[model samples]
Target: MLHSEFYLFEEEKPLRCTVRNYQENDFQELIAIQSECFPPPFPDELWWNVEQLSSHLIHFPEGAICVEVNGELAGSLTCLRISYDPAHPHHTWEEITDNGYISTHDENGNALYVVDISIRPKFRKLGLGKLLMQNAYYVVIELGLDRLLGGGRMPGYKKYAENLSPEEYLKHALSGKLKDPVITFLLRCARTPVTILPHYLEDEESLNHAVLMEWKNPFK
Candidate 1:
């Protein structure tokens, strides 16, 4: 299912790779990685929805990107456009209020929500995660978006071993599925909106925030 993508950024190898303005053409590639990384895997349709939303409402640099390693697609990130709206009072949302994810939203423009990013099995320890993130930081500049936000599940279970490398720890963590805390901490420290909500999965936090974010950052 892996095809050699003739990407414009293929020539650049500064330890980090970027996939700008992702579209339907990138759908299969994205799902390949998403299915590999996420458990219970989100429906394939979600990818289509994201692409539709981005194509319809996403603004400059507020789309998505993928990272390459050794000339192969290693990981991908989707930075979504989001914002706060007066119509929605997230003062009692679950993600912002509960489960402790950031709730802040950008008013003037939109925020970039780091939806998903995963490195292939062979690409760990290459400092790609941090590099991918640093690249996301530059996304704000590219999209002219003031702020970025997203929820990540942290590794609730981790066993650090002297013999194990950092990537080994990360791989263990990823296999254990601990990313929420990572996103929570980053959102808490970053300039994002704060809202209250119940368990993020069942609650309407993402929906509420999406409403606000979409309302402001709708298909441009």
Candidate 2:
């Protein structure tokens, strides 16, 4: 059999990612990649270009990783620190904006608020997701942060919106109610009982689909 034939059945090696600091040049690419991965993707020209600085992807401060395959950019992972309470002295919450509840710590005691990651479909399922998650987890651990939260899931709650029914398409589009059942089903399928937050993410539609898993994080 030719080497090409062997490639058909063999799984590709994981992407080669160089965890490095983001520069000014990497901003547009990041947004473009995000647009590809997410449904309500952020467009490239929207930000006055200078507004790109507000992007957490450019300032992982603690750190970030960009995967490159055969010298081509494949995807990226970002980290941000966020806080809900402004009075908190340790206020490093990236920016006070929507869903800015999660926080990421920077070397300078600043926080980064991250939300999107865009992995090329071809490079997925090869441990990239886990790699990105683990990297983010490490940042929090090294910083000794007790709280780690993100806007949506690892990759924004867009995929769950795909092919949603009209009933599922009510309030919050596909985030709350639709998100719960889908998550619950995934857990059940994994032989784990369906569990969820009591009030999923400030979205009322969540009530119809999720069981009250917990009212609070139980830590705070």
Candidate 3:
């Protein structure tokens, strides 16, 4: 795939950043950014190794993108194409990712599956997350995919797990009555919760649960 350099202008300081495809030299930097974004117990063990990351880049080069700001690796969004069946059962992150290599990726798949997205802590709340999501939308259009699907970890749902069901919590998040750091942002990006996934990941914040979300391609 042909990659292009895109710029983002922050309202306050007008920072110049480029969003582009991953390269061989970016592996270690991506790992470091992932570590800083997701602290310990956030399942760093499940992250991709050099070989695994290489496999993704080889199979679906355009699916993985990195953000550079002031010549620093700031964030990245990794995805894969898969044949989706709404009636088919949903798979866990490990199952779909093949432990991170995305061995099951289907080149002709009509749905784009987001595998992971990470932003450095120092760069959070700077509109980078939304920028990455917008880029994903363009990818869907570029590939002519039907929609983008992913399991969103409910980082704030654990607090009400005993009191409210995942569906109930999602309703609140969708309605703007509740503010969940992750889900709220996804909602703002036009992703709608489709279902609740139990035991999505072994993390305290998610309480082993996630929300299956989708953003249908408007251009499709």
Candidate 4:
């Protein structure tokens, strides 16, 4: 039931939004959200599956969280703990996340690496993405992790690929001369850019590159 007639709910009445850890029953809706958020050309195989979702629950349940509006799933943020190496920080999403299964979750790791954050189409513009991210910050604090990290996509880069190198494009985007959908959003969420990683993922728009960002825990 790819792109099925689901999550098309009315928001006329007052809403009750709650953020909570992932549960076994939430997997189906989570998969549906993935399909809607990342359509074709986004590599269907990269979407979360039962095996990977189950692994999140078994290995790092606290790092898997979802936001619900009026009892319906609106968005989610899945992460894994890792002993991040600042000296050699270059790594692809596949290598870091164990191909999205997060089977390599390090319980005593120094950082919480965000594997994915997806918001439903209808739920956009409601600040759910930032809300999920803020909760991730709490996760870092509660677990005493040093920081939060992610390889952010730059979906807007393809538009300027012919004229600008990835680094140049990022410089412009950072300076407010241009805006990258993923990169800009992360910046607004208080994540600081660390470096640009080539071949970080299979994203065509990002030219297979990603911007590695971090949000250090103030409490650390």
- Candidate that scores best on lDDT: 4
C-alpha TM-score for every candidate? 0.49, 0.50, 0.94, 0.93
lDDT of 4 by residue, 1-220 (tens): 0011213224554567778887899999999999999887788987899999999998888888998887889989999999998998899999999999998899889999999999999888777899889889988998898999999999999999999998999999889999888999999999999999999989877889899999999986
TM accuracy, model 3:
0.94
Q: Per-residue lDDT of 14-96 in model 1, one digit per residue for the tens?
A: 44344444555555665676556543433343332344334422342344566665445777655544563445544332344
Weakest lDDT window of 10 consecutive positions for candidate 3: 1-10
- Tens digit per residue, CA lDDT, model 3, 93-123: 7787776798879999999998988888888
lDDT of 1 at 51: 47
lDDT of each: 0.43, 0.40, 0.84, 0.89
lDDT winner, 1 or 2:
1
> What does candidate 2 score on TM?
0.50
Task: Tell me the lDDT of candidate 1.
Answer: 0.43
When 2 and 3 are scored with TM-score, the better candidate is: 3
What candidate 3 gets wrong by more than 4 Å, as runs, is none
List ranges where model 2 is wrong by over 4 Å: 1-15, 39-50, 53-60, 84-113, 153-220
N/CA/C clash count, model 4: 0
User: Sorted by TM-score, highest first, which candidate order results?
Assistant: 3, 4, 2, 1
* Cα-based RMSD of candidate 3: 1.5
